[model samples]
Target chain A: MMKRGSGFALSIMLLSALTLSACSNGEGAADGGGKKQTINFVHWRGEDTETFNSIISKFEQENPSINVDMTVFSSGDPYNNGLQAMLLSGEGADVFVSTPGSLFSTLLKSNAFEDLSGTPLLNSFSPDLIKSGQSDGKQYAIPYQLVYNVPVYNKTMLDKLGIQPPKDWDGFLAMCQKLKDEGITPILYGYDVSPGQLINTLVMNLMPEDDSFNKFQTGEVKATDPWFAEALTRFKELVDKGYILKNASGTKYEGALSLFAQQKGAILASGSYSMATIAKQNPAIELGLLAPITTSGSDAKYEGVHTTTFMLAVNAKSKHKEAAVQFAEFLAKPDIAAEYANATGQLLTVKDVKYDSKELIIQSEWMSKKTVFQPRLINTNKKIETALNESLNMIVGGASVEKTISTTQAEIDRNLTK
Target chain B: MKTRNGTLWLFIIPGLILYSFFFIIPAVSSLLLSLTNWDGMTYQFDWVGLKHYGDLARDPVFGKALGNNVKFSLTVIIFQFGLSLFFAILVMKNTKLNVVYRTIFFFPTVVSSVSIGFIWMFVYDPNIGSLNLLLNSLGLESLARSWLGEPSLAIYSIAFVQFWGHTGQVMIIFIAGLQSIPKDLYEVANIEGASRWNAFRYVTWPLLAPSATIVLAYTTIQSFKSFDLIIAMTDGGPNYASEILSTFMYHQAFTYFSFGYATAAAVVLMLIIMVVTYFQFRLLKADRVVY
Candidate 1:
């Protein structure tokens, strides 16, 4: 009888332990003492944590009725995966950052974010920038940072080779040939990383001015159109001509940057985000930016700019909706944007921010001039970008351009349900 | 006996409930989700029946990933098992040198797979890697090809790293099983004028069957579930040439936001693992072996 009683007690204890383990403490719940409401904010920029915290502190000082609990993920797929799980489980942050791509599209489609069309913050950003984050004519996210992708050449190397920065396709090809003849790698681009950038550059340069590429995204036209085929063929010609690095398919993005910094490569086809890192690696090297050259003999030059690099949105289901919106508004303030840009060396979409770095000034000047905004298709369909990247990789591996384009087109068509 | 049985049931009920809540329920839910057209973030989902499975059947990327997984499993079985058994046999006896060798061999097992992947990435780097430097120093420059970059060699390169990281664990299991074998059996074989090879072939081989089964099952499952190492090293890249099913499913679910399709891929992977493990149990069953 005693043993039986003991067994019953033990079972009860085990069950209690299991139950206790399943329970959470609810740390962020509203306090009954009438303290400031806590607004949970999550972002995938661990590199900007310190700067972001300082900005948050300033906001908290201004708005004493609100407290922000910020969580920073270390970036890449893990952040996206975790954010997806949290949003699905109805436990996501009140305010979160999203890229204006597949993730933003998913959030907008699900109505996960509050409609910010009437928000005062919306008026601060340009309509062109704000429209990129809208779905079905409703604003969902506010612009934060701007990133521009262009051809960065080593000014010192170009001067030594007696070649100026190219503005057209013939000059670009001639510079590449000259560099290659001098036993230098002409282009330091990694196919494994940021493969879509070069493809975007080529498409922007080669596509007909009729905006057929945009129409293709809406399913009005196919990717196997003559314009796309021509772009693929031209890209393959560069690969076949050995203008791109011999082991580019294998080279990583960081590896290519290191090569450029070491003066092993004359030109790096990358974005403004790399400027800070490049300067840190080789401060002595002078860098110059040029628009991606056109092969169609068109006199017009086109530079690609990403107006919405990382934007903040308010969660529709957040309990502290007012506080979350206030925090987002604080982030869009011009002073905060300037402080963020100064601390992180990133370009902001906020109006009238001062640039201390000459490199940023040069990039901003290019941005203020002739530029083609990145297409909505590249942002909307991640599968298309991945397919294009993989196709480029295969082309570098000696696959035929026609087969690569067809396979990529098929992949895109199959995955275009959205 | 009835009271004892009741106590046993009481003890097991808590574990059973936890398992049902965490594992079985989620797994069954995922199976149900596989038939839907959910993008994970959306509130609305449509039941699409077996459409996702149909798509998987036609997916060339899925085919490539499965083939890579099979190759990865086979290579892990051969190299991890073979090297571990050899090392176990070498160090089974209690000796100082053997202890040192055991410690050295087992060191990598303590390191996380992410760290191991990063280490191997540097080792396989084409320009500045130690492997290429060694090849150049040995006057074998022609043999110094990109290890993780080439389409044909990337999977094998990753497999070698997996083998290096896990062989120590298998060796330790083999050592435990070796120690459990009765010394009298070896004495008896020697008394009968049997050679060392004969003794090992007849006695050690049969006794180690259980250990080999454990090692094989573990290595097989590990090979199929490989993600972090591949992600950290090549990210299943060089044109998805080295993409396994886990990475493919990850891209679908996280990158493409196709939760339904990703779950279908998960279900297929689970079925593959179940079928393979079932066969392994049958083939390596110890019931027929005599002590």
Candidate 2:
């Protein structure tokens, strides 16, 4: 009985080893035979995975020798965390998608991305948008889309209420008041995620000519500068007047978008990305884009345009660099850019890529005219952004605005020293 | 005897290799990393010994997170242990219905915490959520507020979900302990004219001490290491009100790229759980009550 048991155990062990070897051999065969070179592409566009897959298929069709293996992560911090780990371990994707911001800047500084300078693909994009993806005059990323952060008004509601889109801050306030009097929620703002966006737009509109924000970056000016304080005061006035939603603090980004789509609110202060979602939800709802309303009594117009929406970059340490570069080059073609814009509701930055979406057309008009490419806080220190976002929320929660600003400024100064 | 010892070592080596590779090595490396100023993205890092700890000391948000973690741990232990113990006692008898009841009670534990968090988020959502809708339907409209948005209530709301998710495991453990107690102990007590209260106090309580310790230790560790549910439900927000140590560590490591600081936070959490678990074992250690 003991010998039979031992024989059974031996057979099992031999079987297990054989199975493991077979599996490894199968993997080796798949990787190292007459197959196409596989280049992994990771991106954080969970919503646009279908669009990305379609693009990948087209790219593969054009370049038959290269296969693109795509992985999609949910956007925001989860994607950032996963990408950081992958890069540190030298197992990062051959090609990855990133926005041209502080995270990208940090990765670029660390030499995580391949220098794509002198590539013919770089010449296709507008010079300014290309410059946005560069660090120290070396191109590290290529832009995929142009996004504009401006207030989107419900044109159907506005026409029904006989309120034209406002051109100035006073007119904006008057319109909000009229909406409130008509028992309509004036604005749908999700302060839970980053209250700073709303405050930043206000500051940009109020202090367009003032370069004092740059002073705060250099420690030459405090966050409690009168311009910033005045902006906060105006925001507070809006909150006190109930022009902003009552439960704005509790509402999430998607929740606010849903509310806007349901016509519960007359206006949504969001980026161009929200247009596709809102349109998908309520196709009949007419949407109109407005430039940032001027806070000064003068008639000054400014549009907060974002140049780098989604950018593709090659990993410097990738084993399949040639294949990755080929895929990236293919993505930069004007036809592919137009197809990408059609698939995903983002505007292309390539010179000759003509796409027709009403929202994109309006955003393009603003881009052609008076556009100040918004300085994303993601381009700044994470602590400073966190401090600004939290302090803005606290101010909205009835904390002393002056104290919040000074304290946040102090925090920023401390982070700078670190 | 020598051959037997060699065979035992052969059996143990693979497990030891895995443990060393997966746990001990990572833990030691994390301790070393905690003393540096690595931003995670950059290859270069400076040895800033205890500086992260100093920064953590000065960070009020870290303090708030630690406090939130402690509150969460305590709340989960109370609800999870109390309700689980009560249910375990209820179903300790080997009745046909008891199997069904136990299965029903343990169902939530089998589901992923992320799914539970998402399910609870929908229930807590202010506008179309069932919690608020139910309240409004019953003419309790004033009580219908955003449950996860409120700072004071958010931590408890997450703790309640944690409690709901894990109470079943605790119940199962307690049921095993209850089943192991011989029937004659209770019968002898009944023959001696002892009441159900007296029988339970003298016999069942002391016998269940070991199981209680196991449940407490497991639940405490789980509470301290809680991340996914909070991340999925709150993302530590409505302005950092529901932020816990794990979420804060994650933000520092990934969001802020402060890997060294995040590792320090992880070390502190590890030390806290170890100390708490040690004391728990000491206080609950009971002599064997063999029948």
Candidate 3:
């Protein structure tokens, strides 16, 4: 009886082990006998699915021996959690996308990215734009896209109404009133997630010094400072004047984009990354860049905001490291970068890439003017960023500016202590 | 006799090993991880020894999230429990119409929570939403407001969805319990001239104790796990007013990369659920009930 029971137990244990091993076997390409090496590429830009596939096809045509399998996860928790889960399990992609700032810093600290500083493609990208993917003087990733971090207004509507983009805060207010007079929602503001976007455009011009926000991170500058207060007051002013729609705080990204695309609103308070998407939603809509000008035209130090994001990095643990690096180099080529830029209606960080898309050509005019890098990205701690954004949102929610500032300062102080 | 005992031990060993591998190991590891400052990225992390818990004790967001969780869970339990019990009693006859009603009610439970959240978000949208349009058309424009956007109403709004989705499921359980109660008890109550309410208060209430106990515990757990619905709807936004423990922990780990802090929050959640469930069993004492 004892032997019979022990034999049954042994069979169960073997079955369990077999099941566990089977579940773990299919992650990375461990089959060594395959003739072609396949490298997995993952990114969060589902919108760029077609453009990336086209690029991959060209890359595959050039490197016939190597195959690139691309996967696109939607932005936010799905992509972040999916990638992190893969990394935690030690089966991450060969080449992946990284956002600049906190996410890049976290991955860099964890040594998830390979050192790409030695790659010859480094010289092809603009030095200032490439610095976004660097940490402690070591280049780990290559930032590919240069996006204007300002509103994309309907150029056709603005021109039909004989309204040019505003030159200052007063002009901005006047434009809002004029648009409202015509039964248009002045700004399609989605207070849910775009509070940070709006705050970045406003505070970039409000900074007394270029590194003012960086100082805010190190506790050298308090959130209760006058400039921060002014930024909050400006947000509240937009709310008080009814420039944005009522119950705007409840509107999310899709609803806001839909309203603007349908021409229910005159201006979408979103970045240039959304320009292509807006055009797709309404092909007849002519788009233009509208950076919020806080000072008089001559006194304004910065005409717009820009950020170099969608940094590409090779996974450090990838077996096909050479192929991954080759893919990165291929993307950096000037002609190839221009192809991406024209196809996606995005600006490229590659030094000599040219734009042909009408929307891109018109918005590229802001590239000649002084544009500050998104100051909000200067602080790498997401907690602090969340606090600042919450303060701005609270101000719009009818909370007093002083109270919002106090709570923001307290959060800042607490985070700094950690 | 000795060989029989040894054979029994041999049979139990395999199941014990499997349980330890899956459940016991991860639970203990999470407990240990809560004491460190691990950021969920790298292998290298320093042992902070309760520093995360210390920070959470003073964190105002954590306090608000705890209060929101309690309010959310209680509202779901009270409303969901009452509604399910009422429907279960009404549908106890097991006719064809009643079975169709049961199936119709259970349909939402099978639907994905994320889908439900999206559908409800459109319904609650401030502008161009069906709810506001309905209210306006009915000449109740004053009652039209952003349901999911208001801080005071967001948690409860999501709670209403939670209960609405699962009440059908809970009602099925209660119906089974009602059917199992002996009809002779009701007959005796009628023969003794007891009112319907009195019969329920004495016979049905005590007899339904076992199912009620299970339903109460299940509802509590379900309400505490409202992470997906809350995330899909408000994402604990508009100044963290609707933030609950699960969403709060998720944001800390995934958003803030503070896995250690998040694990501490998880540990607290587990402890709360355990204690609450234990007290529920104690209060009901349904284990002692026998037909």
Candidate 4:
């Protein structure tokens, strides 16, 4: 009887240990004070690590009872996969950042983020900027940064070469020709995310509707449409003119940025978010924002493309939801947002935040100008987005516009659910 | 005896439970999940029942990726095996210089795949790459081209990297096999006035067949597992010219969020590996000799 009882006790002990191990979130441990808690935060913005750490330090100072532990993944698929695995297993994070569109949709479908619609944090952001993080009329995340998703040009180079920023399609072509004639590559392009950004900048003034990417999903519009084909043709023309680098499609993001910083190219076909990095690479580079004018007329609808991305959200399964919310609310505060904007060279969605960075100050004037949302991020289906992005790469690699459009349209057609 | 049995079970119980929960259960779940129209994150999904398999059959990118994998595996296996064996034989003698050479060759295998990928990407970079730069310096400027950017050359370029990275590691296996061959066999061949080629063909080659089998199977799997290197270098691009089955499945599952489709592709990959390995063992089993 004694032996049997001891065995039973051992079994119970083993089960208890297993349960204890499973219950721990690994990092979010509470100390003696019941109010004290740690919140795990994860994001993909490794470049903003220092700035975010400063912000978190400030938040922790104000709320001494809460500690924020942050984890950053290298941007792109690595972050997506890491976050998805964690959220699926209900471990590792309490607060996280998300991008708009397909990733946001995935997070929402998983019921991963707590709805921020009724929260006071929602009131602090611009309503127009907040809409990108919304789905089915529910605000699941708060977009923190407002960025012009267009090419950032070297103002110093253009000034020295006596070139003006083009306002129309023909002017843009002429500008490229002139840059090429002056023994300069007109554009520096990267292989990874530049193709999508280039296509987005090109189609912003040309796309018939603001939500045409979604319209493609519904079969209301198609990739084979004349607008998209024109975008491809224009992209191809730049390649044919030898204005794009001979090995543009082979260049990585950092390589292109470095080349552009060295004055190898007049324009870097990445967005305004890259301003800080470009400055870091070459502080002497005088930067200006240029959106490709696809239309010939001065009555072009949008001056550039803008997106409210780098969305922040409280994880739904967070044990310290109040602390997570508190930290988010701290970020929404005007002074803090202003500090973030100035330090990171980013424009924030927070109302009445002051900009101090020279680049931010210059680009801030374009905020009031007519700017469309990043059309690429409007699609809920990522497969369609990937196909469209690949279409741009295909055109860059010398594929015919007809084949590119048909292939993309077929992908869109097959992916349509509605 | 009873006490020994009880102790044995005590050791086995923990590992059995872990194996069941971690490997066996997840693998079975993955197999089942392949039948459903699951989007990975969403909880609710309908049973689709082999529809993903049918879709994969008709998918051109999947076909292209499979073809690339085949081409990649064949190229890596042939070149990696032949070169490793040749180097192994040359350095098989237990001399100080040979040891140094062996260590030098095996050094790359110890480095992480990501670092190797990054290093090779720089080497293959069209403008600033060492290859093109070297060609230009040698007055061969016309021969210099985008090594990774060209679709026709991308997969072969990646395959060469795989071969370069693993040849030394595989060479170690052949070296071990060479050392195991009885010195008397070579003496007998020499006494019979056997030519160098004839001795190697009869003695070293036959004795090395088992190691060759291991090298072949390992290189095959390593080629398939070149997902990280490919992702870092070309990301299965210029177009899908460099994509293999593993990268294709990763894009489908993680990038496109099509868990069901990706799982189906994974199942196909598993079956392919199993059948190929089976054939490898069978083909080699005939030549394997026991002392």
Candidate 5:
């Protein structure tokens, strides 16, 4: 009898413990339809994220049925580095943005993102934009927000020097000489190699001004073609002329921005993102976006266009797929697009949505003419930037432009294939 | 004593379990991971056996990174050890300003590393930084260069900042070691007519070796693992001049999403550290001091 009683008590205790454990595991996971839904969004957008945050609020108010759990990632490498590791470990966000090149290609091949094909969201977005999001015509992510890298100059300085925006490469050099002769630094450059402030600077300087972004991505022309080399050489000549700050070779991206913002330097080769944010922060200085100087003459066949696509893709493994899709649909609505565009000072990606900012409207017009989204970095060519950085560093170290450019061509040729 | 003997293992068991779960399991898994080409996503992996190790030999960037790591470790090991020893001795010299000197020297170590990186970045600012401003103001314009931006000087520039920040830790450790050394040994040396340098050489130096060894091993490991300084100051840039193995692993795993290859790189680092541990234990093994 005593043994029977003790055995029964032990069984009861074990049952109670299992119940407790099961309840803890099952809590908050069970949800019936029509209840409030929560979506997790993560990105590396930093303090410039205010515009994004306001847009999120507008989203929540309009669709009170959904709640967004936004996580702003720390800036620098950790933002992107740990993102997928978290995803693969089943711990990352439900919806996140990724760069649209080799990283995206690699992720898509791994079957990391949910298919958006033939969905309501798919029909709503531009097919060309989706094509840009895909490899050989399969969609993995959507264009989040498109931006273009352009050259920005100090308007007050330009006016003082009575310089009209240079329509040709020679005129640009003469203007740089004028700025230098006056003891004002001609260019605020941070040659801090690779993905430094160089991204927009070099691209704007080099990209052919005449081709569609689509043609460039589709390989109608090559990045190493003479048009790019001419641009590259012209950009390097500014360095040789000592128009760019000497310390720029060592400058990091942020270092150059802060320097430019302080009005210590005149010419800045950067992005549209720089335009909106710098305008807000540096109230003491006036900024004007101009046609970036190019290697080709004014009548050159190509004009560099600056446009970027930021996508928000749902993680496939999440159980909240329905909710995630619904939230994505909400994001695609014209109203949602307006909120995002207005907040970011970005031109919206949705066709039906009206461009909000004047800058956005201008950029949209430019994108229609001659802009190529920088080639989505090929996976095999992922290390291409390292070569770019090394070459840039070599140039600043006083290496011959001929040697640097040829060596870069050699590296890309050797490595961009398996 | 009885309770200690009885409950020591019992007390240690929880920590041991946690350590095994968190550190040991992950470490073992890293070794397993090193053999595969899993991109840190999904359960799928391609077993490459020793390919990653072989690839390490062919990887020029990895070679550059490894060389950088070794140079950083050596530079930190020497200066960190030297300044720490110098400060420890200075503070222990029974002088009037010793305490104040010790406090000032140790202040940098207490601040965060990211802050150190930022502060140094400003100091090296080329356009309008105080370092250059001061230099130029003093008519030393020729001496001003972007200290952190230059390819040849960036590595040293970063290491010096680290030395300023971490030398305090070594100094504090040495101070403890110095405090424990009996005055009687010094008294005997004084009676024997040995000079100050001679006393340090014969008496103080041998006693400080254990502490020095501990500091050396610690700083060596830390210097090899130095990331925040490089990340914040340069992000291992200006043509990969300041790139270290850890940063390279970081790029592969975090930035480039080649985490499987990155894990392989980490495994190499772990092996190097294990070798270093063995080397330190062999070299620093000393008889126990009774005093």
Candidate 6:
């Protein structure tokens, strides 16, 4: 009874403290002209929150009438829960980050954004980027950054080995074989299983022949497609050949990246964004970007990706609708995009934009000249992604590709049906 | 009297409203959501009652996650409780500099979990981890491997971490429980010619039951909902060896937008927690423990 009483008392005290903090902050913000209007800006870039806040500072300067209250969810938890909870309560973020995933579409249908179809800033964005931001018949979100998935290799290692860059599947395998013979692990990948594992990079590389996502997304492809099976086989082969880091199934992204930076590994299955990070961490780390390896023989196709390009959406229930639009417009500006790219290691969709980010410059140049755009289709289910990631991790770690692929196909089919 | 009761009810109304809005409503709606095929964010979710649950039965990942969660919970219940009790007893022993020791021990508990997770990752670093590096410098090279990267060792490494991160909280609870126990019991046990183990087994153990119950509940929930540690440590990877239900749910819903499917997973996890807690509460018949 005493313990219970003490526990209750502690809770009450903590509650009071939280309430006090809330009231004081709320009061300080609200002490302005009549009833002050605050825009709740929600995002998941805490590692870059300072940069985000600087952007917010610019927004506030541009619109002196409004104060921006920010909500930052660490990229790990990613704020989706809090967002979902608030959204369901009809009181979510005023200006929020939107993805092409299910939640973004839900927010769109719920009328959680203002119609910005004919806005002045509309002409500033790329036609493809602007189109990617559409839902039904309205433009709700603004494409913020374009990210691509591909293989990155050690330039010094390949050069020292006197091997040309892998242009096709056979060339890639030959490179892998050469690296293996030289006692170097070919691809340093983190395959920790569960859903959404690093399989996306491998899968993208292996399935260049098929626009797998395009087919599955349009309801035009079977879950049991032969290409997916082929992708599975290729992933298993990478594992069987010891091309992947020996303990990749246990390694984390940070671990893998660190190893690659140390020159202990040859190839890293990473996105274009990583070039800048690699350079930042190790400036002298001679790196080269390659097209995601698909089909090793005569069928090799070096496809590019336009997926993971994030956008900002005005919350449907935002009170400061005009200000939110202003925020999106600001983020889309080439100059602002350049700054954001420098800060977040990404690129603006406008190819010609000279980003302050050297990483963005290198990646964008590589992308424009070669890679294919694999936009993450809006119709894809996250469970399917998870299943694919898990299945790929399993395959790479010596699990049966056939069973895992079939199971993944079944899950994808089931989720799509739902 | 009626006015006082009315005032109390009025005060409680806000709390009730908040509770229903934040907790009860979501819990109820989640049940409704589990019956549908909501992509989690899109407005177009079709009701597919029990379909997801049926599919979940065939999900190998679900089975793996479930088994892993149970194993984690059971380990946490044992090691965490055992370590906490040991520390609590040691601290409860009359000694000088107890405060300093207590503060030092609990230092980790007060720090943000993210910090601990990151620091521990460094400690377990295969090449540069201070732990392995120290061992190697001391000519113990064979003992070190990629602690976080090896599938066979990742889950245990992570579980041990959580055990370390949480031992202080559990210890404090145990300390509180031990202090609250009357010293007269020890004296009475001595007069009865009981050995220290016997006295501990009969007297101290029974009195610690309440603390045990609370500790078990906390660890059970924590282990079942293990995410931050796993995300920080292994992210259920190398090959999903360390994945628990929370990571699985987050990946399913947020990463892919399978809200209804994720909800089904969440519902299953919740049921498991409730059942385990219930069974434990019944097992202890906790009412038998006298203050």
lDDT of each: 0.80, 0.79, 0.86, 0.86, 0.71, 0.72
Worst 10 residues of 4 chain B by lDDT: B37-46
Considering every candidate listed, which one attains the maximal lDDT? 4
User: By summed lDDT, which 10 consecutive residues of candidate 5 chain B come out lowest?
Assistant: B282-291
TM-score list, all predictions: 0.93, 0.92, 0.94, 0.94, 0.87, 0.81
For model 5, report DockQ.
Answer: 0.52
Model 6 chain A — which ten-residue stretch has the worst lDDT? A192-201
Residue B227 local lDDT, model 6: 86
- Candidate 1 residue-wise lDDT, A358-384, digit = tens: 677766777666666665344467776
Candidate 6 C-alpha error for residue A69, in Å: 5.1
DockQ-wise, the better of 2 and 3 is 3
Over 4 Å off, model 1: A1-33, A209-211, A214-219, A296-301, A305-307, A376-379, B1-8, B286-288
Query: What is the TM-score of candidate 4?
Result: 0.94
* Model 3 alpha-carbon drift over 4 Å, by segment: A1-35, B1-4, B286-288
Tens-digit lDDT string for candidate 5 (A240-311): 899777777667666777767877677675656676666666865666666544644655433554444567
Fnat of candidate 4 is 0.58
- lDDT of candidate 1 over B1-291, digit per residue (tens): 999999999999999999999999999999999999899886789999999999999998898999999988899889999999999999999899999999999999999999999888878877667998999999999998778888899999999999999999889999998998999999999999999999988888888888878888998999999998998888888878789999999989888889999999999999999999889988888432665
What RMSD does each model have against the real structure?
A: 3.8, 3.6, 3.5, 3.5, 5.2, 6.3
Q: lDDT per residue, candidate 4, B155-232, as tens digits?
A: 998998888888999999999989999999999999999999999888888888898899888988788767988998
Best by DockQ: 3
Which scores better on TM-score, 1 or 4? 4
Query: After superposition, which runs of candidate 2 have C-alpha atoms over 4 Å from their true positions?
Result: A1-35, A192-196, A207-218, A291-294, A297-301, B1-14, B286-291
| TM-score-superior candidate, 1 or 6 | 1
* Model 3, C-alpha of B189: deviation from truth (Å): 1.4
Candidate 4 regions with alpha-carbon error over 4 angstroms = A1-32, B1-23
